[model samples]
Target: MNSNKDIWVFGDYRNYFQNRVTLQILARAVDLFSTTGSSVCAVVFGRDVDEYVAEYIAHGAQKVYVMDDPALNTYSIETYSWLMSHLVKLYKPETLLVGATRFGQEIAPRVAKKLKTGLTADCIDLELDEKGRLVQIAPSFGGNLIAKIITPVQRPQMATIRPGTFQELPHDYDAKGEVICLPVPEDLPKDAIRLITSERRPSEKQKIEDADIVICGGRGMGSKGKFKKLFELAELMNAEVGATRPVVYSEWASHDSLVGQAGKNIKPKILLSFGISGAIQHTSALMGADFIIAVNKNPNATMMKMADLAIVADANQMCLGIIKAIKEKIRT
Candidate 1:
């Protein structure tokens, strides 16, 4: 278990390329492990998964183990857990990283339990301790403190990283690596649950993380009535509405609409934050935004400092004014 050590980044694949989270993990693992004399390998599963091996290689993985199986195409807890557990037993990787999606969260714990290992989920930062062990850093106590968790004795230190927590490596078409095709193990169990139908909602109403434009509200919005103005402005702009932790805890918005270190990372084309003070816990995830416009009454707010445009004004009146002006323009 100790001699053949390597970093294994689970390449969570969607309909298109490997999910962005996997690449982010790969980029990070490559940066840390390559110098420590550990190779980076991507473990990908799906029907025809080999097609993605080269793409992963370009993103800095030295090797890829592709599990191409019809049964593994869609996410099945039973199938994924068994295969990964078997692989870990055979190879005994030093580190196993999974993207913290609903699928990763489900399968990671199962696989870790099977291997008698420890797992740290939703980590915001990562570091290598002096012992060369992985350090999993995440928010704690309502983002007041940063907690570092490590599995000191575990052979394969496992963790699930939040999406948008890190940047992706630039693709290098000329880069090359080894690709291994894995066959479906004979004893893998069949999935009891099945997916029947699916639908894609319009971006305006889609998940906040996937939205192109995001309008976020904070505690300074004052009350529920005032917070509702964010939605009105969002409707006019065809954007998604997001909230800071305080706003969500106040029941002004749903948990899915929350953004930041503990919630979700958002990198929209346009990010308009209203009344947000912009703590590091909240601002860390907004790294992907192309244009940031932060509105807060306090000129010294962190959000204002990070924003391309900072407005020292009342958020409610500004939102109402924008909505009214947009409506008037539409009439013309």
Candidate 2:
């Protein structure tokens, strides 16, 4: 094993804090690279971001590399990619794990091309194989087959990792780690996609990924009018609403609310599905749910067979019944 072969983590920021996805990626990296005596180095860049260094260290990075400068204040693909490429050439890391976020997805490929290395995107699983090579597992061929990708010849095997694919490491308040501030590359072009103005979108109170109880619909939901029932159900239980790919494609739900191989992987405490036929693409994402309760008209549906509790009935009628019963109970 190469001693210089370190695991570099891209600590992507959101709302002035380290994104949960970045912490999730570093946690897995720390576990895998620790066996090889490889340093888990987290790279964070922003203006006045000294606050995040300790948090990253608490999440399992042995070394937190900070590049705090006004020039790195706002995120730009051009500047970030050039700087990341510089770090790779200078430090010669063995593996680089990036959060497969909107920002990360756009930047990872650019940096990979700059460094002339292979990059695997949106990996659901990552492990070091018997040969000490990085193995990236992800879905391929329209979510029909699982593909294992490896970069044997690339110096640093790079991967863009999805959140909720792995559990985050617990914070060790008593743990002590190093924080080394790295100087920003001076050669970065100033004219690289200059930002004129920016506006922030209002945040949602709830999202499927963060919900403890999620109620998702599928093609069997029948129509958009019926699809609104999921919202009423969610309100009754204070649960978040998710949907299968078909439901999302049909515009019954937004893409962010989609739970499947092609969408978000949610690990709710209670995952309740209605009228879902249990396609493999949809079922795979529910592996992390604590409890799965399925209701479908068809008793032989795949989701029903795999559910912890399967109710054979009319999904719409059942949903209305539950809502009615709850309201009546409240009145009493």
Candidate 3:
């Protein structure tokens, strides 16, 4: 296997549904290494995976490796990681990308350990250096600075990228690729944990991470009623509402709306911050946005320093003003 010619992506699927996040990261990887002669390949593991190989090819995977088995119908940390390690050994790919999802968090470290390679987690960007090695860029020191990491001695350089950080390429249905089906190991672990049940709960009213525009309120909103006005503004803009960790911990908003290092990492096109002090944890998560507009009474807040535009005003008043402005614009 040529070290500089093949890149592998862990094609993540859930309950027979293909994860678009994998395609998004693959697109970015293609962009990062296009000048080099490297081709992208996706390794998928699931039951009835043949039906999904075309989807990965359409997203720029030159080849799709399928490891299908009934035991993989639901994710088992030990089973999936073991399978991935086997595939990596077989392919000897130079780079491996995985989505930074719950499953990814569980599986990537285990695979890295098995392969004895470095794994960079939650990477926002990727690039290639002069020597044709990958440069994984992720937040460091609580998002105060972006760190670029390289795997000099690792055989398969591995990184887990955050979803929404990469743009998915336009699909080409006419794209063609080879699908190799690998047999599951016959000597399966008899005591392997089997999935007992699966259920889907009603999703949250808003997924702030997926929202294109987010209006976040902080403790400075003063009261619950004022926070309600922030929701009104979000409604008028057809945006999702978010909150700083302090606001959520204070019961000003639900934990679902918390946006920070410990909360959901968002990469919205526009992030509007209200009444929240930009703590390192919160700022680290939102720094990936295209545009940041922060509103706070304090001029010296950390968030204000990093914002593209800053408004020095009370949180409630700003929310009300924005709601009125949006309503007026709609009427016109």
Candidate 4:
């Protein structure tokens, strides 16, 4: 509880398999150890969380601080905030990292407020300054510009990183780490909000982040009618459909399918862009695409310039042609 210079990551494993943000942050924290010279640690609060502790070690955590108790069986924002803030005070860690998931968004700010520290939210990248201070990079002015922030005055610099921003380290079963169990304070106060019941409602739609191939459409597709054809193409090619903000706002696509700074970041192996102008907000999220094929009438469009293969043509016509080609290939 007294390691003042260690980098700490909060373990969020509720959607352990589906949501890998916690592990991703842990990997990034581990990378920082070389520059910051701080031990990479994870703090987990849950019941029967030995598996998660071990997983953290395999994923690059040098040590883990666990608070295992029946009281932590369910997540309570107030209770979690109080406990996390208390832990920060006790440990005095130099930096704390949390995933920018909904759960993290709710708890991180409260803990920062309690400890009188600054927190940067939804950071796209993290690095150390010349003085070894944490530099948090995120979008500003509605994704028009990027900002690098540092909590120079705070003891525990805090930040919530966007999901899919970084890749997790591969599991190493032979990795060694120390696990120190911490006792939950007996004087913990009752939470103001209580969870009466919980239910699981999983989405059947493919998450764009997990997609190997992505078919992305933009407002240049003209109307909702033309935009809907991307789904057919996606199905034919076994790809996920992504949309630019303008297309989503025009009701041509659902918000869930949006790819932008405000939406989900995707790192698809292959990305096919249709009629997109490549606004930075949309382009920034797909920077990790391994191969890009862009179809647009304007050869000078940003998307076309960024593509590995740019085709100058009507997006709708190209989409229909690709679909036809796929069907013919399947029949043969």
Question: 75 in model 4: Cα distance from truth in Å?
Answer: 0.6
Which model scores highest in lDDT?
4
**lDDT, candidate 4, residue 217?**
95
The CA-based lDDT of model 3 is what? Answer: 0.81
2 or 3, greater by TM-score = 2
Most TM-score-accurate candidate: 4
lDDT of 1 at 121: 84
The residue pairs in collision within model 2 are: none
What are the per-residue Cα lDDT tens digits for candidate 2 across 265-307? 9999998999999999988999899999999989999999998
For residue 161, give model 4's deviation from the true position in Å: 0.4
* Global lDDT of model 4: 0.88
How far out, in Å, is residue 168 in model 3? 0.8
Clashes of 2: 0
TM-score comparison, 2 vs 4, better candidate: 4
Compose the digit string of candidate 3's lDDT tens values, residues 27-143. 887787777778788999988777567777877788888888887777778888988887788778898899998888889999999999999999999988789888999999999
**Candidate 1, clashing residue pairs?**
none
Model 4 worst lDDT window (10 residues): 198-207
Candidates' TM-scores? 0.60, 0.61, 0.59, 0.61
Q: Which stretches of candidate 4 lie over 4 Å from their true place?
A: 1-3, 204-332
Assess the local accuracy of residue 75 in candidate 2 as a C-alpha lDDT between 0 and 100. 78
Worst 10 residues of 1 by lDDT: 197-206
Q: Which stretches of candidate 1 lie over 4 Å from their true place?
A: 1-3, 15-18, 194-332
Give me the runs in candidate 3 sitting further than 4 Å from their true place: 1-4, 15-19, 187-191, 205-332
